[model samples]
Target: MNTLALRLFAIWLVVFGSVGISLASEFFSEAEKTIIQSFGPWPPPLIADPSNSVSQNSEAISLGKKLFSERRLSLGRDLACSDCHAPDQFFTDGTALNSAHGRATRNTPGLLNLRWSSWFGWGGAADSLWAQSIRPLLSKEEMKFTGKKLRELFSEDIALTQKVQELFEISVVDQSDEALFVIVGKLLAAYEETLISGLSEFDRFNVALSASDNIGIESYLATAKRGLKIFIGKGRCNLCHFGPTFTNGEFGDIGVTQFITKGRIDKGRYQGIKALQSSPFNLLGEYNDDQQGTSRVRTEHVTLQHRNWGEFKIPSLRNAVKTAPYMHNGSIETLAGVVEFYSNLDEERLHIRGEKILRTLNLTPQEKKDLVAFLRTL
Candidate 1:
């Protein structure tokens, strides 16, 4: 072959080889996508089922909603669930930190689409809603009432006691301490399971996008779409906060606030799991008959790994704008603040192994605004 022809032939061979490799790479990427799509949905739906058996009854729901707002449930007769999770504020009252008789160690997460969660609390302490409701009742900073004193209140208040008794078919006994605690927990759980939240604008927008009605969605509303791109793509939020509920329903060290408050290192999930193990009010306790045997099995057999330290339950993003002071410790105060935290997360402070990838994204100003705007739509 001529020298010029030989050079062209070599160039063609290299180009063809590169193109073949590129085609294989593309095929592998698509295959990965096909495997994921085979699971029926990309972001799996939340507990959107209206016929949730645990909270299907109208009477139970009504009582639960009323009780949710009642402050008298606390020992000080002041801090009800509504004190933190008010209905008007998408169930959260927008506190940087929760306080009642005393300040709480963590933020008050909103109660939106909770019917779908298999676990509750920042540590995944409770396996069911009924079981989850009992935590605040026993906490000194929350309700602060012992099971015995709570029963006394039930006994003294005839109407209150009667309502509870009729609802659960159990009498409030002054002497039987165990029975009183059990009944109180059960009644409250029945109430919480009913505190479901309304659908957000994000859900509708997602539905629109799913149906290929992209033009019908607004450009300003496109901020949320861009945020969604960042979240599931370069933002890397989907590593932990995945699925339609915007949570993997697992634990992680998301670089929240542990060192920010001097001397108040709330050991995150490490101590939380230990506390759950010892807690009598927990689902494995004698009070947890309603969760079937599922609660007992989980509590008794559960094991905690070392990495669980500083790991907290991933809260749903359905009402992200409503619940301020994000994280288990309620350290960050606003949605914008939260975006900023993740954007500029100090890698030196993160406490997990092999966590080199959580470097500061150095998000642009517009990216930050667009991200916050999107979170608000949720």
Candidate 2:
């Protein structure tokens, strides 16, 4: 190859440490550029949760932060939300399924950048963040506390009672079990909403792309660029895990087992729809503070289908490096493992009713490593 062609080729070449990377304006297609640009503009537009009146409230955020670590929410008064969602561990306990208070069926999901998400949890079971917050305290396999227990904790505690009164301008003693329960959930969500991830290396590369800074673009590794081509190209990951937050905020069944026990199945989004529709805490319910009812449409129209049986939320790929044991069940241990799973995906293992979006990528070993290198920048 001539100097011009060689230089251009080297821009896409995989390199090791100390070897500088580069990107040419002509490297990616117009479509690829559009897809790459869609990954960010870091820290997406901050929209307050209408369902939770105290979503952005300062007092609510403070109180919620306290409550997140408060063990009193648990029936045993031993487990706290922070125990499973450790701050240093990126709000995940680093376990496949958290067996803290008890054996949790699904993996403990990261709590960062939750404000951007309309639906919550692996199955998108909770239509609102506050409702999702209440789940840990009520789950039989988790903290396993009841509404009455939660009400008692707040009502009986002198300091908590005062805070509750000050925050809501109402005494906790006067509130019913369900009412107090909702208040705590709202407060927890308020604090949780602020837990956003910072700009990753990928975001910086995106900034370079936007500015047409060839030097700035060079900072992104060459192997990653190859992986990026695959990601937005043949891998078709951007189809689902696209846009800001790196997810479509929809569910997919990527051939993961849904079995909870011998013959017992988790019934992912199918049961999630049923739970959301029946729950009083859903966006359409009375507890929602959205007097305008602006956020109720998604919840109102959600219907259960046989296709949803094995479907789980396509989690945000932001900070994918920190949150380990990937998938709803936390079955994949490493980023490489996750890549491997998709690379050799079993179509037969997929739900019969599930969409035929996924197929075995059959990635070569170098392709796998390159993809992982690209993912780490996120």
Find the candidate with the highest TM-score and give its number.
Answer: 2
Which candidate comes out best when scored by lDDT? 2
Candidate 1 lDDT trough over 10 residues, lowest sum: 33-42
TM-score, prediction 1: 0.78
Per-residue CA lDDT of model 2 for 1-378, tens digit only, reads 899998777665645212442236667878889889989899888988988989899989999999999998898899999999999999999999887765878998998998889889888889999999998788888888997787677657888778778888887778877788899999999999999999899999899988987767877888888889888888989989988799999998887888988898999988889889888788888889998887898888898887888889989999999999899988899999999988987777663655587778999999999899999989
For 116-233, candidate 1 gives per-residue lDDT tens digits of 6767788777666665676777777778767656766776778877776676666566336656655555555555655555555765655544443433333226566567557656
Question: What root-mean-square deviation over C-alphas does model 2 reach?
Answer: 5.2
Q: Which stretches of candidate 1 lie over 4 Å from their true place?
A: 1-54, 218-220, 290-292, 295-301, 351-357
Clashing pairs in 2: none
The lDDT values for all models are: 0.65, 0.87
In model 2, how many backbone clashes occur? 0
